[model samples]
Target chain A: MEHHQSKSFPISHVIGFVVSLVLTFGAAGIALKTNLSFKVIMWIIGSLAVIQAGMQLFMFMHLREGEDGKTNLVNMIYAVFMVIVIVVGSIWVLTSGHAAH
Target chain B: MGIKWDEFFITGDPLILGSQIAILLTMIGAVAAITYLKKWKYLWTEWLTTVDHKKIGIMYIISAVLMFFRGGMDGLLMKAQTARPEMEFLNSQHYNEIFTTHGVIMILFMAMPFLIGLMNVVIPLQIGARDVAFPQLNALSFWLFFSGAMLFNISFVIGGSPDAGWTSYFPLAGKEFSPGIGNNFYAVALQIAGIGTLMTGINFIVTILKMRTKGMTLMKMPMFTWTTFVTSILIVAAFPIFTVALALMTFDRLYGTHFFTVSGGGMDMLWANLFWLWGHPEVYIVALPAFGIFSEVIATFSRKSLFGYKSMVFSILGIALLSMVVWVHHFYTMGSGPAVNSFFSITTMAIAIPTGVKMFNWLFTMRKGRIKITSAMLWALAFVPCFVIGGVTGVMLAMGAADYQYHNTLFLVAHFHYVLIPGVVFAVFAGLYYWWPKMFGFMLNEKIGKWHFWLFVIGFNVTFMPMFFLGLNGAVRRAYTYSAESGFAPLFMLSAIGSIILAAGFAVFCYNIYWSIRYADRNISSDPWDARTLEWSTASPVQFYNFAKLPEVKSLDPFWHMKKKNEGLTLFDSEIEEIHMPSNSWLPIYMGVIFGIAGFLLVFEWHIAAAVAAIGIFAGLIIRSFDYNEGFHVKKDEIHRIENAWRKTEGEVHDHVS
Candidate 1:
């Protein structure tokens, strides 16, 4: 009788998940432990969260599997860029001249 | 925490007392009428609990029409108060309430519902789908919207309408400044409506993305469907920001938390940012559908395919994308500095390019084809010039320096009314005329329709055009009454007269609708306009399941192309399988009622009871969801029986005509 082989999970996905977890924990740990800049910790955490979201989207949501995957990805990126520009730019411009010391 | 019945009584005023009585009476009357007409069961089964998109859409339109009358009455009140100098007909506070309610109702209750209703009715049909994805959610969304509208109107009687502008700018709207139930009503009403809008957005996105028929690619989708998709996206991304803003405002009002209170370590500007973030996209959410309506009307009447279809689609998406960045343009007077202002100004100006592309697309659509200037087509044509002027002025106002002069002036009012009235409202009217035949198996009276169109267009321009001059001449907006010595009285009088004309036009339209429904030909042909979409391929007054047999699309103008090639042939197979549809449920309406009651209680500070009720209602919804009842389907033989009857009638008519 022939033995049927079960499919294995991709090594890259495991690596990506592990890295995301480490980064998340590291950022939290740094914020908790250090008198050094907390803002830097927040930025690192935020970036890590964004990356994790992307990884999950691609690896889990199967965003890149369909015929329209490239188009959908591009549209999402554009939307994200627009969002960042609006939110960040609004804050920067509103505060640039009027920030109290 | 217990129910604060004593505190609720303390907040009461006589004005509120009076209005409450009036609202109660109206509700009683409505209930009595429903009972008298023997429509209780029918309303419950067909309208309130219906998961059918077309039925839900019709209900939405009915709700919006009712709200339009309420909002229009508010507008007339404002006009009446402002008509004469030092007019003591209404107090300043009353006038403020009137205008605020008008703005709120017109945008939220009237325009949004109307557009959404049109989309719900038409998008699935156009895309060759049986119904929208998540039909039950669609019903819930409509109920949510209805509940919000009900809450908003109820504010007039219960306490007072929101006195702050529809924008509800803070400092004025904050708890310290606005210590009343009015602002609470605004917050809760919008919160409820905003949820509905958000759900609708998600529903449409899912439907458009996942439920299009085979061969109906994105590029090949109708312009209206494209607009629906983009508008849904706008709703998903933008409405959440509004929800957050409203939630914060609610917290500030109810819990003494400081989100927008300036002295309480909160920023008023944050409210402005959040509101405008949603506000700007909201303009496109309304306008894009209007654009789509024009595209369809122009193409069908002109006997041509929509010119620059790809560009038009891209332009809609572009506009949706750009709308978010340009919110700051609304507040150039806030001292955002030249750099910030310039960035917003340039972005706002950039939007004009895509809008311009759309304009040219419409004009070219009418350039060389056999144009039939029906009432709907006339509205589309009138929209061209009216919306162009509005769009141009929009760009003008986008210039930071120019906006300084225009901001908070009647000019800004004129510009928006120009766009909203002729652009959004007229497009809605045109769509109603165009699709009435399909929805109701009868044509509206062309003679009466023409009267409505011409009178409306002329009166609209007359009413709003002078406001531009008034703004330029230094007249401010939101004033309850102006003095004769202020040199603004003549223009104000002119505007008031123009408003009367516009009201007259609306009256004519109402009359036409009434008359046409009573006396017009009952047997309207299925493809009355010989249009392109899948909707025209179905029976007039589309059956409950919509398509008896699913249509096979061969090209962009599937119905039109098929008719030309195969001599009015359909590829729908006679052998139809059992079609599964969603069953009607009372949960959505019940949920809406619970929310409405909770809102009323919260607005009056009856928090504990309201919270209990809310939890109970949600629990009921969850329990109801577990009770799955499979919907019945029309079998193949039943479909054939219905189709053969329709065919025989059609054949008899054709023979008589020939």
Candidate 2:
């Protein structure tokens, strides 16, 4: 499977590497430097992390390069769905108990 | 929580002391027997180091059975103590520990492994793969799980057993209340095992998705394989929450963090929420496969195609998605209020739709068909009503307001036991009976199996049926004893008697294992049950390289279809290819031991030792990266020899090949 490794200039790896680093620092800066409310700050950082992870999957991890790439994408999407359920549900259950309902 | 050297090795309980001695003797005896028989190298090479999924699966089954008996013993003790009012058998603390350990071991250590063992043994073959996606990782998963289980089991003899309920909700599990190192076992041991389970999830997803034979599309996969795929997805999604929860718990207990502690702005309810978030889907992780097992068993025995096979697939998928939302039903009375409660309650009740669909599918499967009543089929058949009782009661408890009455009551206890016993335990037995000959070389004795089944199923009902009443009669759970005036005695006594019968049934099961090994007919067909999946296409006591030439898959129940068409596994003129098999590695076991030591040290707050052991664990990973163990290949001549031997004994399968 790894036989396709080439001696070509790997621009994708470099781009993914720089983007991941920037996202990491960018999220940290938002959490530490911003005067935003806790909930807002958390949302910003979580979104950044998800974006960074998606980039890593496509660019660095080659998640979309294989024959099973579509399946991998679906698995990740399901994982993201579960994460949203857990995070959103926990917040709803904990703080206001979702009085809007 | 401070560690006390003198408090180590619990001395007061006579039962514990006896067990401590028994454990020592058993360990010594095993070592001595291995040494005397001069089989240490053989053991190390063949059993411990081998990456064969079948062998690893057998090892899992053995550990799960031992733990099952241990958990069963704890259950029996709890029953004996509660059998009558004011019983003096177990003090409150001892009773607390017994019940807690019983819940943890039965759910985590027992049921999970039993199903996983079957999955490991059967999934690859059913999916038509040589091994899992990663064979060495599979080995690692098993050892880590086994080691973690051992670490948890040792807690009773060592510092103390975790006295909190198996749920291990915080404040109770927090260091202030649980001042000993007991719940540390809950945190660390389960974390270790949870990682193993997570890896197993990933391994299976890749295997089922990527490793299926030609012509077997996703829809064409057998029901069991499909269930396994769904279960793996649930495991991956759910267990991370447990791992995170346990990590936080470890931090709170050991480093004195306040993630779950009462003070320092900690939220205790978060632990409960997180636990059930993982815990609810965790049940389906075990249950869906049982559904798959029953699908295979029922269809095979009834001589029919599974009724609503597509619906079975989609319902399990629906159940998995719904499971995530309904965890809050576990704590509806925690005052999440009407909106949250109703939402969760509705989702909880909604689960019954799919579950009911499955329940009827099984019945419709047997409807107007040639139903053969094997011992395995009997278990599958019996599961319907028992699970229905469990599921219906579960729906009752799902009503948020109604749960206020049921919470912490034996009614809740009765409800789950009804569900899990039939849903998980009965399936284990059915799968065991159905697949025994394929694993070993002979069938389990049916007459003795009948005794085991009748006694166990009856005992199961007799023990738990009264609990629903006792619970409704205002009996709280985890109460060591009650006064005669409370009038909970007669029913408790009846339950106790039922437990005794259960124990006897289990004893008969153990005896059946021995009897079958010694005297059951060995000259059985490879397809002992005339079964439908690809697993039966190979020889009984299947070869190290499972299929000599990989079997072609034309449709669902490929082997059965092959039989109908008067076909063999592969073309007789087809050239047998040399097979690639993973090499044996001691690294997995070594990693387990290292992690076990680290976890043990961390449990007692011996930081330096744990850190050193942690380094050893890391060293294993480092070594693995550099190690180029590309594995070995089975030559064509060897494959031919093995194939000929199977055909010689069971010429029926290959008779039509030429």
Candidate 3:
């Protein structure tokens, strides 16, 4: 764990890059070659997107590195929750219910 | 070159013409006085280019006070206009402009910068940091805000003031409706200031996070520091939305884009959503700091450590988070239906719980403790009950079904004033009085401060309480006058009288400052209040380098603990060292001027000239980016001398008191 904390080489970066590549190509291949329904394709791609974001947050940003790591992680999760509530909630309410349309 | 000379000159109204003349004369007089005194260089070196957070904070306070005067005058004129039925004190357009400027200047210029000023001055000292993380950037923030304010202020005498409203909502704010450069000033000025505020947010966050004294954990930080941290987060998250919203509005108004136009694929509600998305959090950006200030004042005066310190921190964070989600409640009647309104209603009401927790914490802190009735504590005490009234009415308005009846009425007006005046305004006064000795070297006159407090509180209640009744009796806002038969005459008259009284209260407060500065004793000790915070551990009118030796924090209220244990209270045992301070530069002022020029030119549709000025701004930025003048340092001998003098004075003060 102590050795891993030192970024004197590119091993972690390479691993993160390779994993991101596989996820991206896997989703693209499913969309292009597979005859899955549109909803199913969207689900797969969306899950892939979430995984990519997590990778970026953990591997690149080092969300859990210092004393503030836990606070940072919690705040990020809370921020995501708020964004979802705002964007998804706005779209849901605006497109349905007693909206003007 | 699309300027219309007639509209640009802003002629026709005698009242406006008189005011324009008065403003011009004032400007000339100020310049002449400065020139006669040969103080231009002194002003430039000491103030305009200084990177000291304390000096910058003083500049912010002065500018914000001037703006408060301007906004207050606007308020008085509006009240006079509506004092009686068919009053002709101001015409419809003039009334519209006054109220619009009043709202914009009061909130953005007066309240926002006033609080930010206090934060800049106090936060660094509280956390035992030498200065903010980026001292030069802090100076840049102040200059930008000042330039924006100056540009917006000139709108009254030149061109015209924005008449659509402070919100500058769609269609009405579009070019077809407001063809002049008024709304353009609103967009460009706010954009400039908003950018400044955003930099300040980022600056303080980095400072508080990375610059704390040793052993001062997040949980061990002062309440003001905690509040500043959370407020900074809110600023970072919320200001960008405003930046985008204002930019879109600018494009729509100037370039004829349809982002919020009624026709051509434009959606009006998008502006509302984006505006409030930022606007709601902007309230807490001003408010949470007030909460922090109250916590400090309450604990100091009550002679107790803050009760439920962890809970207070959580409540502040909770309010910050909740502030974002509750923006939709502002426009619940915008026809998003029960599903949307109910969701927002619940979230809006949920905010009250955290806020209530904070109120109770303050109460419990004061309980069974020695409570000093200082002016600062008086303001804090007044804030509790007044803010509760505002909060309760807020919950009432949060009910989706009931809001239809209360929306856009004087009741809405009353509710917000209750929140803002008591919450933000009272807190600023409390902070000013509490931190007066630190900022200056002397205390404010307590007797005069009491006069300022009582008059302002009574005047505030008198001004706003009647609006609730009048609003219930079918009185609407933004109306210049109502018919005599509408039966709002008595209440309107009463409210206008209350405004005059409020103006008097403000006048007394200003006078108190003048009197105190002239006569207040300067030989007072550093710790006048026997306060528990770290800031109080320093000398009054703190040195250029805040602390000669950085304190080692062992617990919460570190100073109090040091005093109680009679250990390490003074740094006489520690060796003095050279202190590095950021060098002052003229780049920020240059950038501010160019930005202001660009903004003014854009308001007149001089795109080419504006573009050139914009390039100059970027050039200033580029110079700043490459500049290698890191700073200068106070020599060890100089530090030793300053520290010796401070100790001598401390000894004298202790002798005189004992």
Best candidate per lDDT, number?
2
Task: Give the alpha-carbon lDDT of every model.
Answer: 0.84, 0.90, 0.89
Q: What TM-score does prediction 2 earn?
A: 0.95
- Comparison by lDDT, 2 against 3, better one: 2
Give the least accurate 10-residue stretch of model 3 chain A, judged by summed lDDT.
A1-10
CAPRI grade, predicted model 1: incorrect
The sequence of per-residue lDDT tens digits that candidate 1 reaches over residues B571-624 is 255446777677888888888888888888787767887897789677867877
Give the alpha carbon lDDT tens digit for every residue of B1-658 in model 3. Answer: 7657777778888888998899889989999999999999999999999999999999898888899999999999988988899998898988989989999999999999999999999999999999999999999999899989999999988888999888888888888788878899999999999999999999999999999998899999999999999999989888988999999999998888888887867788878888888999998999999999999999999999999999999999899888988888888888887878898899999999999999999999999989999999999999999999999999999998889999989999999999999999999999999999999989999999999999899989989999999988879988888999999999999999999889988999999999999999998888788788788777788998999988889999888877777666556635677788989989888888998999999988899999988999889978986687868989988888877776667443233221
Question: DockQ: which candidate is best?
Answer: 2
**Model 1 chain B — which ten-residue stretch has the worst lDDT?**
B649-658
Question: Candidate 2: deviation at residue B127, Å?
Answer: 1.7
- Return the lDDT, model 3, position B243: 96
**lDDT (tens digit, per residue) of candidate 2 on B49-104:** 98999999999999999999999999999999998899999999999999999999
In CAPRI terms, model 2 is classed as acceptable
